[model samples]
Target: MTQQNPGSAPDEESPAGDPWHAFGYLVAGVAMYGFLGWLADRWLGTSFLVVLGILLGAGLGLYMTFARFNRPPDPQSKQEKN
Candidate 1:
């Protein structure tokens, strides 16, 4: 008697749902790390920390984005639905 939408499940949240979320994560990480690196550079009189920070931030941001968004749907949810 219940009608469910085809191809899209109620509990399923596709990663493509909100791209800005990922973008924000990446940008925030880069900015924070870059700022820290700049501070270290100023304190140590080194110019490479900024670049290192940026790279580290980008890597971490990407990792977090994937980790947070790329989760497999819960098997229990599907079982319960059926």
Candidate 2:
């Protein structure tokens, strides 16, 4: 019989294992697009273009959310323990 340490390292890559990576990407994309929207409002002197930019940013965020959830599991999951 053998005992496995409960504190043994996880089976996933730590940095890449974090689910927040997708969230960070989503926030960055949204912020960039929002800034574009503000710039458009400033240059065009109208809110229409700004609104459009925001909508486009929202679409990008939605797509990224879907992509993150669809990604395959970490490769370490396939490793065999002796």
Candidate 3:
């Protein structure tokens, strides 16, 4: 027989889990894209490259944001037994 703990479940709602991780990921991605754009502009001496970088970065960031919302609640922190 297995003993279950309160609020412990394989699937639980945690507001502090995925949102923070997803935000961090989004920030890092944006920063990376910005850096790449700066590098491209510095090396190529063209602003178009930077613009492209921004567009790509924004697209990727939005994708990640949407993906995070689609994911299920955290399983590790779920409290099973009440």
Best by TM-score: 1
Instruction: Write one digit per residue (lDDT tens) for candidate 3, span 1-82.
Output: 7765666464454463467777776777777887899898999898877677777787798787777777775565444422
User: Tens digit of lDDT per residue, candidate 1, span 18-75?
Assistant: 7787899899999999999999999999999999999999999999889878778889
**Cα-based TM-score, every candidate:** 0.77, 0.55, 0.58
Which consecutive 10 residues in model 3 have the weakest lDDT in total? Answer: 73-82
Rank order by lDDT, top first? Answer: 1, 3, 2
Colliding pairs, model 2: none
Q: Please report, as a residue range, the 10-residue window in candidate 1 with the lowest summed lDDT.
A: 9-18
Q: Identify the superior model by TM-score, candidate 1 or candidate 3.
A: 1
Q: Model 2, range 1-82, lDDT digits (tens) per residue?
A: 6664566664534343346766776777778898898898899798777677767877898788778777786565545343
Q: How accurate is candidate 1 locally (lDDT)?
A: 0.86
Candidate with the larger lDDT of 2 and 3: 3
